[model samples]
Target: MSTSKLFDSYKLGPITLSNRTVMAPLTRNRAVAGFVPNPLSVEYYAQRASAGLLITEASQISQQGQGYQDTPGIYTQEQVAGWKKVTDAVHAKGGHIFIQLWHVGRISHSSLQPNGGKPVAPSAIAAKGKTYVNNGFADVSEPRALELSEIPGLIEDYRVAAKNAIAAGFDGVEIHAANGYLLEQFARDSTNKRTDEYGGSIENRARLILEVTKAVVKEIGAERTGIRISPVTPANDCGPDSDPKKLFDYIVDGLSAEKLVYLHVVEGATGGPRDVAPFDYAELRKRFKGTYIGNNGYDLALANKALAADEADLIAFGKPFIANPDLVARLKAGAELNKPDQATFYGGGVKGYTDYPTLAEVKQAAE
Candidate 1:
């Protein structure tokens, strides 16, 4: 009978979360044919239903949105059907889930693009990295700057994906504007070199994300729409924003105007050091008037401290959720967490996906 704010119920928009702990989205690259969720995904997510909320791995909103091999998509009926099972399973265990809508933009290879075309981006710059495609890693293809005329269609894609998510049984949808992905590429100056309306100023760079957020919010009420943003994360060769504080403050202000249900912020570098930059996370927290989910390298002690200080309304755990399906129980009891097998992290079947045993199982095994 442990009691902590982290384990308390929370009301997020229209749905109520069992606890404040969220399972952050982690790409497993295990989608089957047609970029549909693998059958095992149903089991994988269902096992971690104890978390207050679960955000599934990034699923592309369109074929052109994909940047990796075997990632799931939500632009088709089959894909929606695949996800229906996943959502049903989570709900069956009295849990809530949200699907992250993604568009990789330039962080993609030609093979992963439709008709072997170049990936699209805010600028025609090639990211200094590789993307998983054709069953292996390859230099990302140089991208073509998205035409202004194409902007409307991209925004529409997000709206439709949000609609499909609700149809697929998701409690809500998270707009993947974080990482170095499509939306982030448009926001960061290092990657976006366009002089068009979508580039040049912090407000301009933040336009696409804001428009997409509004579109999603319109399609599915503000409470059902949340957005993720990483202000200073240098992931996906986004380099550094010339003024992260100014840029993200503007972004958060717009997101707040949209009246989104939550704002999931990656505090520092994604999966890296939390003190990688000097930006003030509290600034963004103050700007946004919604549930602020603090992510990146959060252990139990840090989570407690952040919650106690009111730095974040909820805390998101990434790797910890991968190895500990019963993460809520483990954290409550101050029990040791299972170490995730790095080898089976990506493109795996079942060994590391759903095989992690809970503390109860471990105790039973010893007995």
Candidate 2:
């Protein structure tokens, strides 16, 4: 396949991207004692600044929003200052970045939660996965259903986090609502069984996400707000939605009213087969007029095909970015890519994180 299409420029919100490729958010538990993006993360991101856009790993909006160990948060002043260095470094290298605001909901342990309170979700069910905490993997604990009174505060958390993101010098913010996290817990019918306004029907199940989006948009202008959603992703122990196409179509149509900069959708299961469900990508793409990012299992050929057919405005690569900091240039030059070392993916030093040699560096070594 010709690599011309992936190299084409496109407009995203107020900034003009050099290309349509995006570095998908990756969860590397590399943070300071205060859960701030450290100097290592700064270098890690700056190295891959050539991508059209870089999304930071899912950052907890508040302490209560965290689900894993050492993941950064956006609420504190120290965290903002730490992230500022990262954004500044990316900007210095002529790259744009957006912080992904996140909340893991029930997929958390008591040690990760504040005041030793049980993790909060739309319902009090335990997910079927273990979260790596401190230095070991622990089973996810059963959660406490969120109180009605706490809903307002939850929205406020996103509002404050959005403001903090702009303060940290990010060009924009992407609301993390996918992959069976907090927002997805409320979005999917199987996870959410509440009878209140925030549960039950699709509209009710979608209320929390819409409210969070509205709050974030209010804090940072609509043009700078983007959201991610997975219609049928069973990741993080999520169950299948009875009617994925109808459910996600309603979600896409509802999100359009917010005038978000983009809607990022994971076409199928995360990190699994691309055809895990029967939903139509074109249908979901048509529901939203704004830019659509198609993520989950994409290579150079698929990325070009999607853009050439107008199926997606952008493509996000996760594992590939881990070892290929010069992915964009490599694709353009048709060069070989280095394999990623998964053992060093989380809570590690510069080895697999930022030590991956560029194509030029590799060729020079060969000579």
Across 40-152, the per-residue lDDT of candidate 1 in tens digits comes to: 99999999999999999999999999999999999999999999999999999999999999999999988888899999999999889988877778899999999999999
lDDT of 2 by residue, 1-367 (tens): 3456788888998999989899999999988889989789889999999999999999999999999998999999999999999999999999999999999999999998898889999999899999999799999988999998999999999999999999999999999999999998988889999999998888888889989998999889989999998888889998987777777888888789888999988888988888997779899888898899999999988898898899999999999999999999988887777889999988878888989999989889999
Off by over 4 Å in 1: none
lDDT (Cα atoms) of all candidates against the true structure? 0.94, 0.91
Q: Provide the TM-score for each candidate, comma-separated.
A: 0.99, 0.98
lDDT of 1 at 168: 100
Model 2 worst lDDT run, 10 consecutive residues: 1-10
As a TM-score, model 2 comes out at 0.98
**What TM-score does structure 1 among the candidates reach?**
0.99
Q: Which stretches in model 2 have alpha-carbon errors above 4 Å?
A: 1-3
